[model samples]
Target chain A: DARVTQTPRHKVTEMGQEVTMRCQPILGHNTVFWYRQTMMQGLELLAYFRNRAPLDDSGMPKDRFSAEMPDATLATLKIQPSEPRDSAVYFCASGSPRTGLMNTEAFFGQGTRLTVV
Target chain B: EDKVVQSPLSLVVHEGDTVTLNCSYEVTNFRSLLWYKQEKKAPTFLFMLTSSGIEKKSGRLSSILDKKELFSILNITATQTGDSAVYLCAVEGGGGSNYKLTFGKGTLLTVNP
Candidate 1:
């Protein structure tokens, strides 16, 4: 089946360490989104890209978090000098918007669970 | 900011029972509302409602939206243990947010046999 792929289903890191999550979106989808989920914050949109170009990343912390789509197929989210508050499940979703609107039918990958101690 | 709120943060029911999950939103320039079911892994697409008062159905699951009230409801009849999952509601559309999705804190459903 054509599904979004994520690497390292689980990751544990020490404080001040770096963590990177990779995602391979389903072929042919033109939009990719990165989200972080936590018990307190629920689901928060960190960043999103359309046609391999970033459209918005206002939700991400510029100092520590960065997201990029190197190509049409691969997207990455990185946290440099990760902190405990960054522990959460990060998800990657992709879809093709219908006409001029944002995609309502989005597909998500099995999230990457990160923990920092 | 566009916002979505789901009711009854969690619910528990027995097999064969009928249940309804609620989702309310406040978004500018509304385009569409979508529902998803998430198990232990990724969330899977369930339904997308664009028009007001139109119902979308598949198997034992169905959903309807209300543009006037800016809300939607998902109904599952004759629930099974396999239906135990988190139901998510997402809305797309807002000023400068046409390419972004705003999600709710899904409702967790637990069905026991």
Candidate 2:
């Protein structure tokens, strides 16, 4: 069975550190999405790429947070000078145009938990 | 602003009971509404609804979307301890621009045996 894979399932970093999370989308999926979940903010879309090109990153903090799809199979989300408030579970999801109802059913990775102190 | 809201926030039910979870959204360029079952970690895909009055089903879980009312419902029949999890609802919007999903605060379901 194909599934989205993520590395470094858990990480602990001090404030102002640089942290990077990686994801390997299921083979043949053309769209990848990055989402952040917190108690106060719920699930928020940080960025996404379609066909290996960024379609949107407005929700991402331009200064510290960046998301990129280096290749069809690999996507990355990075944080520079990370803050304690940035602590949350980051999820990577992959989808194909042929997916359920209007291509909305996305396959999610077992999220990476980041704790910034 | 586009948003999705889920009701009850949390629920407790006994095994063999039935439960219904709700999701309401106000989104422009709505494309579809999807349901996901999240246990301790990864969220598994459930149902996706795009049109009004059509019910989608898988085993004892079923879902229906009401585009006119801007809401959807997920029904789980004969709940079991294994059914305990967070149920997330997300809306797919910006169909022409790019597929962006706005998710709600999931409903945490607890099924007791």
Candidate 3:
């Protein structure tokens, strides 16, 4: 079965450190999304890319957070000078429009659990 | 702002019993409602409802949406211990080519044997 693969399932970093999370979306998917999950805020959309192009990153903190898809197979989310509040699980999902369907269902990876001290 | 709300933030029920979870949303140019089950890690897709009055089912888990009321319900019958997890409700809103999903806090369900 095809699945989205995420690296470094867990991470622990001190405040002010830079953290990078990587995701490998399903081979043929065209849309990629990055999300952050916290106990207080639930799930928040940080950014998304369609056809390897950045579509939206409004929910992300432009000062410290950055998301990119350099190529179709790899998508990355990076936080520079990460803060304690940045501790949360970051997930990556991919989807492609199905033939004759208006919307496509997204497939999520296992997620990277980041803990910033 | 677009938002999704789930009721009964936490719940506990005995195995074999049935439980219902509620989700309500207020969004502009609504598109679809989706349900997911989150356990120890990432959430898994459960159901997606776009039309009202149509029910979607998979074994003991089923869901229905009401476009008029802007709400949806998820039902689990003959619950098992494995049913314990956080149920998340998300709504897709119309926008540009990039469609974004807004998710609620999710409802935590615990099934006791």
Please tell me which predicted candidate would have the highest TM-score against the true structure. Answer: 3
Model 1: per-residue Cα lDDT over B1-113, one tens digit each: 88999988999999999999999999878878999999888889999888999999999999999999889999999999999999999998755544578999999999999
lDDT of each: 0.91, 0.91, 0.92
* lDDT, ranked from best to worst: 3, 1, 2
lDDT for position A94 in model 1: 91
Clashes of 1: 0
Can you write out model 3's per-residue Cα lDDT over A1-117, one digit (the tens) per residue? Answer: 999999889999999999999999999999999999999989999999989999889999999999999999999999999999999999999988777866667889999999999
The per-model DockQ list reads: 0.69, 0.79, 0.76
Worst 10 residues of 3 chain A by lDDT: A97-106
- TM-score of every candidate: 0.95, 0.96, 0.97
User: Which candidate number would show the highest lDDT if scored against the true structure?
Assistant: 3
Second chain TM-score per prediction? 0.96, 0.97, 0.97
DockQ class, candidate 2? medium
- Model 2 lDDT tens row, A1-117: 999999879999999999999999999988889999887787888999988999999999999998888788789999999999999999999987663445557899999999999
Model 2 residue pairs with clashes: none
Q: Write the per-residue lDDT of candidate 3 for residues B1-113, one digit (tens) a residue.
A: 78899998999999999999999999888878999999998899999888999999999999999999999999999999999999999988757676767889999999999
lDDT tens per residue, model 1, A1-117: 999999889999999999999999999989899999997778899999988889889999999999999899899999998999999999999988667755457899999999999
